[model samples]
Target chain A: MSEARKDDTILDVKNLQTVFFTNSGLFRAVDDVSFNVRRGETLAIVGESGCGKSVTALSVMRLVPDPPGRVVGGTVTLEGTDLLSLDEAEMRKIRGNRMSMIFQEPMTSLNPVMRIGDQITEVLRLHQEMTSREAWAKAVEMLRLVRIPEPDRRAQEYPHQLSGGMRQRAMIAMALACRPALLIADEPTTALDVTIQAQILALIVDLQKTLGTGLILITHDLGVVAQTAQRVIVMYAGKKVEEAAVEDLFENPKHPYTRGLMASMPAVISFGAKTDARLNEIPGMVPSLTNLPPGCAFAPRCSLAIDRCRAEYPPLQEVDGDHFAACWRAAELVGAP
Target chain B: MTDQRPLLEVTDLVKHYAVRGGVLRRRVGTVHAVDGVSFSVAKGETLGLVGESGCGKSTVARSVLRLVEPSSGAIKLNGTDITGLSKAEMRPHRRSMQIVFQDPFASLNPRMTAGDIVGEPLGVHGLATGRAQQERVAELFGQVGLRADQMKNYPHQFSGGQRQRICIARALALGPSLIVCDEPVSALDVSIQAQVINLLIDLQRKNDFSYLFIAHDLAVVAHISHRVAVMYLGRIVEIADKTELFANPRHPYTQALLASVPVADPKAKKLAPMIDGDVPSPINPPSGCAFHTRCRYVMDRCKVERPTLVKAGGQHEVACWLNDGTGRAENS
Candidate 1:
């Protein structure tokens, strides 16, 4: 990569792997995943449950619980610094300062007993050299930035006292209080109503642009990905099955799994259109990550799977410029150009 | 085929729970869960009721099935008023109307086999027994696209989608004319959700049954329902044929909801401007029109007087003042 390109890249994750050990045996939760987020761009990691999307975010933050899970291999490079080699103290200083994350559920993520303003102020005090009064003022300002009405009054309220949408806004305020270069949000708007979800999504996108922050949005909703993300990564059973620009992936998905997922979603029909169409189904359930089939993880459910698919795992190959797929018959897939 | 006479009719359904406060537990206010709601289902039609949380859609479903007693209303099933029936008389009516809950895992008893769970309804109503019930159970299993052999396993052994199928099979065992499905496929994954939805549609075709399908997701509702009703607070804001409702929504709430749905197309146009505030509390809901707090076209009369459903055009009915000749002249 050129030096200028490296300078623009805010987060570069290469060959990432995370594994968990249970009584049933150890299984790879995230396997050989790689991606990069440029400054001011939104990169979405889309997948179903247990497909290791959330684990990938945790791995990047070095927040994976150690007893049963660990990031065994990979290099997470954040703005020219190798995060894996950093000591605990140094990593703590970098975290919530240069990078931050917003989890899916705000009710549990925020401290229940503490006032919302205090929670945001704690991050400012711990990470930056700010006095108590300065931190409190910055905390209220952050709430205002997230479009929370009555920021001064709302800052004194507890998490439970506020509505679901308000709690989520507070979470965003706390996450963005430091103005981090990289923001990782895992399904931030999944719990709210569609109207409220639109409000929250618009807020996130607007803030990202203003701050010039590189965003890593992890979600299972295809509609959200299409509306918000610039680039996309499709994951299936702990592997990156396809990667492409949002338009290219939706228009011409190269991987069979990606194509199946898109087909399964029932689109909101246009006005006055007939409603006789049945939604396309991917016949079988997602394979268990612990006891996966030998070759491709998705072979049992893929309609195009052949003998070769069951015999060998396909390597990620470039199907077109900046578009990649891990399917053995990527060229033969019906939507592939 | 839809019959001339509707299979179920719910008229002026009102259910309210009292809110107690202080040490004496005095009735301070009432939570208007479902207030004066009315709708009907044809013999084989599916009526999709959609709204956000705390909007009383679930309350309407529960009232229709008489699971929770409604404070006041008339529920007529097959031309018979079943609202005032005693528990003993309601037993026979229960066989004709069944309910499928959202969480399949919590609904089914873990200790019981899938076959026994499906056959429980038969035994309860004394519809079948012995080898006859076994044959009926196996038939229902096959009807729901589950293998007869898998019926011997417990609910734990089955996947989420399979558990939902078992719930459907149980509901089918009674041979009901109407089934109230409360977010049946919301718990499943996207791929599995599609499979279950297809199965439901196919089963409805074969059995010629009516469904009062309730969900918060509009796309799924658009695909499955013949007619759609949009609920706000505790009232139906708009009700119309699926095509008409989506194409020409008259109510401000209904229009805002349709515009809020994020389309799957990446290059799709920007989302329409959405409503600003959260749904108000149901306990002390906004007076007069419940949706005036967030409505964009609210007028002076809207805050003082409530609007009832009136025919806008064709079969479409809306409760907004704008559509009832009270607000804007262009809309009237």
Candidate 2:
């Protein structure tokens, strides 16, 4: 079973550590993170802001700036090719062709001056060997594929003319224009309203299934993760504290932080189903990466922390089946609600 | 609980923005940001105004405080109409209300210390002076779960969650009866959001203050609100008890809003959008029902005749033709 899983894996990240040389000190943004994405599977990296989920996405795309930010360690292999080993030109080819990315804010991510048609077609013209006319036709098809209404007319319109949802559809059109093997969407629907977000997420899932493409959805919303992803990796203070199948992660969270996050979120519970009004708020804030604790990063806020938990960092270990958690007391918290 | 008077009452609230064009900057069109919306918040109760972006929830909050002058409306605070009051005359009314904005970083004065940020409101309202003000600020800090020693720290020195606590402390300083929480916890992380939300709930319990909570998120709204008013294209589509609204939303828009919320239960099936298409542009809003274009149960009458808010029993009400006691809105 493991061998079959390994064979089908499209992207594999191992012990990845990324650091930013800030004025204060060196901030380890992505601290020894590792995950795998199989073909046609949706893997979600869920965490709060500044928890290094975005940095991990950037690292995989090889888009991190070198002067301040650097991938200090680890290997990111896409289709059996180590991305870190590739040169700038080779990596550039892989960036848009084999993999694509969509950002949080659709308004700013899209080109303001350029028409939606030209932007999508430009990708086709660059990577795929297509003429202007063919690229234009493909661009309209791409927009149509994303379920944009009046694709023919919308293609001629500028980004500002289209609505927020329309702009996001256009962005997805550009990203999926080449039918990339891997699509990394970092908070694609965060700026969108829930109604619009539902549409975009549905569009993404439908398109992903139809195209059989691997997806790495980076977001802070567990709801989005539950709706889209098959597997989830929960991050905290730049560390992967929990990794499990989406259902397992939600049903039996083995990490204290993961449990705390699920309890903290007010969205998951139904209206009036809550016996208690006050959410079980995690007592403290995320630890500063620049000045991390000597032991577990989440020890200060965790209710399950013991002397060993505070004295040493726990390594990621499998507690149940494929459900992995980086906590000393993972065994005690197994099958936890 | 003995006081029967509503803390805040808004009636026929309308706020429009002019769309200027070309070199002359002539008023070309009008964007009806908040078009004839009305609601009430009882003392010690939270009236959650939930909607999509640009749906005028924030505008309603701002208009209630007289921060943005309403084009037309009656805003009665504790039986006093302050909507037509002058800036100077509104000062006293302002003391009875305050707002905690969405972005704590942008809302706070970076130059001022946490102490000054909380104390400035006290000084401006003349509630406290010098030594008394300092003491009040420290007490407020303690109430919000911030350390007294950290009162002198700058906004930038604190974390995102800490900054929001400071903003909350500042809002609480005036001893306002009504506090408008404008997405107070949206900017914070899940764990931190809980902390802030719980803090707000505790503060409300202790002080018996009301909140005009405006947020796009339904789940967060349901957490605190006693009653909820769903908005779409600057109109109140439905208003009901939190339990009823969330469990049995009558309006198609409200139903869609509830269904669209992605519950973090992966065991559940993948859900589709209950409604389709985008909310029509507020600048050129639809003629009859502003939500008719995207509404699933759109009818011919829904296209021409605007549906007014109709009672469906109890505190439940909806502004949809489908809920006209008929099973569904069908011209046939």
Candidate 3:
């Protein structure tokens, strides 16, 4: 664990700006987002839907299609090499070989006609130029690594033939086939049930420890993050609002938005018989990026919003130790319900 | 004191779909979707049905609602047998029982406004006419925490939470005594899920309505339900109070299911029992005990002889060979 913390940065995303060209206007789906994952640690990007968490992950991998989406600005550096500067062919080589991404929906991400073994072997053969026999053997090995039962029988089955949990396991197997240094998982267990979710999270954590892989886990479930992630990045409306150690974020959340999110979690401890126990809900919906307010994006909903909050955007400042919060009144907003 | 006169009583409810095969499309096998499941919901209590995916929890819900006709069973609503009633005959009782589906966006009619969606129930039941119907729809909107003026808005215009509220308002239009909520909050985000769960709790308190809340999330279910029932491959393996089910689960399957839920607090260490292998296919389920294949304490008797639901402790019942003391001599 100490060595993982000291390893060189595997991924450094700086000031990444992703925009969506809709009929309405150019919407900044990812606005000046920046984060980094250590060589063997997990950095979780936590946010609700439409909060640009997935958009930021997609931007890093350059998977966002160009017709309706485009990465207008950013420097995605892997081991000091600028990924954005690379050409399409070079980036393609780096994508599956260096930094693989496991998408949210395995049912759609997987090739319908291809066998599970062949799908993984295809990545190996395409990237490493391995023979069919070699790729198949490597594919089976990868499946076994993920702890998928009866790897041989499972490899012969098609994607549709496997269950949802098995398909997700298969997706993870494919992502880790090339021994990618950084694995970006976007809501990997969202479609799964609680029991299956626990298993998947444990598997990911175990694999990370064993393979010494850096992970960027993007999810809305705080429970998943609490168990797996070493650091947590809180996002809202295309902006990075808070970044801190997982324990710090849970124990002493500085940002009003983060506090509200933490309070809203229906834990067994917080709930009681009282029906009127008002949850700390940050009122109002997430503002549309097409028509974002000039000041702080969260000001419209934040309870701690003051005149300054409504007038100017706040820079991400270090609040306590290594904890960072992008709020105008981060100091004043203490012990928020 | 068991209430024999509960609002809804389901006895050995079973729903099996026949697998078609060969050129003639003959029934080769039966998929035991909801096999011999039983439970009762009192007047206003919420009996949460929770299990993993492919555990047949949803099938039990659909069977109880009569949405998907049960293959064989007894469904008694308010002491009246409603299971055998045909579609046309069940029309009168439809108002007293409603369902709030999982995906509100898909369940709602796209062409209809929010007002029409809620008002359709009243119109179908012939409970209101013209002006009276509009007033009732407005009232229903207010009950579900939606603004009455926004009745003209379409489903697409509302957010995910608001859309689900619309579904709830529609379900509550007829003042149903029981509303089967099937994974209502699973589709929403964490914050939004809290809002909807709170709303459901508040509404139930006000109306004294009974709910068959079915979801895969055990934490949410534990918070809302007074009693919880754990389901395996189309069977209620264990049924107990929420606290008991959480603290001292009897059956191995129930224990494993409860152990698997990840707590939000990282400091709290729980020994989660890992159940290896995927749920066996419903097409050809395990012979004796549906959960015997995955049960850590499987016995020889469990492979051949099925265990029926019997009283294990106070106000709790379990259908496992271990609990019945009929499996192995060693304690489970």
Candidate 4:
């Protein structure tokens, strides 16, 4: 609590480096990642498949697997305590109690054999030390809070008995059973229907606000990021390419990759196409982690790449107040054509 | 949306798969997968079919390609009826129409190299042999943005986006007049998805082939499609031009579907969901209008009467009772 003001920081991560040791070489899944989440703030990590956004979140929770994936260097400080320094037993005590995670696939996350009621109550019993009757009652209450119709009846049903949306809501209820100080939702509604996705997203935002909980939403969908996150970190090839306030990021993107991403998205709301060919696709492929290009990893694909960019890696630096971008030509990219 | 010289016209397409149960394994009832769907794809035009998961949009695509035998309908390719043609009789007509499936990896044979995968169509149809097939395959590979040297590489050697490019080259082997794309880019990442979409658009412009693009993502569909069809529970609820459909969606379901899509601009005010409740079972669908169960403006009449696709404004059509009485307003 003395490390930083309680009002300023709820979770702070510094120099996070997650790597995978393969036969080919050492692959840095999350390279020197750093960020912080203020209390009750929603921070979204935006990236494509291999961008290490998920790895960063996993690194925060200390959930990185050992052999292949190891959080070699990082300080995931939560409420003045470094999660990385904590032992397995100490971390487990705080895992679902103070910090919880909701995975992308709800079907795979929840136990098929356990009833929805028991799942939620299991978290309550473990974290809060509630009695069987008290936990069961609270479990039903949480289900009702998530707006699951007939919560009492749904409590008895197994995971298979519920719809995709219902199963996800159950997972949310279980995650929020203890009112965790922080919630990590990795593509929470990607697998659900669009209609149901809206409902779930709205529910999560509302609940997080009501509980005053910090949230880290990991997703590839920019639309969802725009709608949900106050601030966003755009990751590319295991490195932070750009970070800015959501509004600033969308309105005037700094990095070429960020701009390309914004342009590539098909008109979500077709308000008379402004550009001839709306989608400006980023050419070439996302470079392999093992054999990344020399200097800037994105140099091979970057349209604005220069000789200097190809010779040395670009460090993520502040272009303006609270807006950071890792590109050699970040200054020149402002007011880009 | 019907233009001159329609390349593909599907009329009253219906496909009902049998559902069997009990000890005897007798036919209990029918799934009613695709019930009375109709659409036309003009020459060099793209017709996007969009709907929820179990909405039978894929069934319509499959039915049109004769991949699944329709219970009743007429499939006209270049104004020639190929509906009742037997396998041997329809063999040559297959050149006029082709299909590209969803999964890029699954669609391509793992054992076959990229060259073999794209060149197999030419060999199967006996259109070319040896050196000629090799030349055509190399040409297609280059056209789809893949290197000619990469042809020897197997499907597993390439990434998802490259594999999809190979699949597109395969679909283009015979220069088919119509290509049915069933969620081709759904599986790839957002960045890679754009490349594949751009490739498709470029190929369409150069080669000029009509497309029956089926997908659930309205944004992607609206980008490539000339006309868009919104399906719900085995029947299309609304059909209109891409801009018209996205601009002024008449049906409540269409409105909801469009609203459900989260806009990329965070500054915009959040759109509250118009309706709630999951899609009812297709096995035992609701009586009368299929969407009536979820429609916010549901009426007593909607429960008893099945609404048909009535002409609304311009080329737009809606199948809801709200648009029934005053729906038939001809613009011309």
| DockQ, computed on Cα atoms, for candidate 4 | 0.60
lDDT of 1 at A251: 85
CA lDDT of each prediction against the hidden true structure: 0.90, 0.89, 0.85, 0.88
lDDT of 4 by residue, B98-144 (tens): 88889987898899999999999999999998999999999999999
True contacts kept of 4: 0.56
Best by DockQ: 2
How big is the positional error of residue B167 in model 4, measured in Å on the Cα after superposition?
A: 0.2
Q: Give candidate 2's error at residue B19 in angstroms.
A: 1.6
What i-RMS does each candidate reach, in Å? 1.7, 1.8, 2.9, 2.0
| Model 1: how far residue A134 lies from native, Å | 0.9
In candidate 4 the C-alpha lDDT for residue A177 amounts to 91
| Pairs that collide, model 1 | none
DockQ for each numbered candidate:
0.67, 0.70, 0.43, 0.60
- Model 3, DockQ value? 0.43
Tens-place lDDT per residue, model 4, A1-337, is 3455456687989999999999999999999988889878999999999999998988998888888899998788988888988999999888998999999999999999999999899899987877999999999999999999999999999999999989989999999999888999999988877888888999999999999899999998988998899989999999999999898888778888898888788875665763125477888888999998889988888899999999999999899777999998988876532
TM-score of 3: 0.95
Find the candidate with the highest lDDT and give its number: 1
CA lDDT of A230 in candidate 4? 90
After superposition, the stretches of candidate 1 with alpha carbons farther than 4 Å from their true spots are: A1-4, A270-276, A334-337, B1-3, B269-273, B326-332
Docking category of candidate 3: acceptable
- Tens digit per residue, CA lDDT, model 3, A1-337: 2565435788988899999999999998899998888878999999999999999988899888898999999799987779888889989998888899987789999999999999999999989978999999999999999888889999999999888888999999999999999999999988886667778888888898898899999999887888888899999889999999988888878888888787777664223443234444456677778888888998988877889888899999999898899998887766534
- Candidate 4: the clashing residue pairs are none
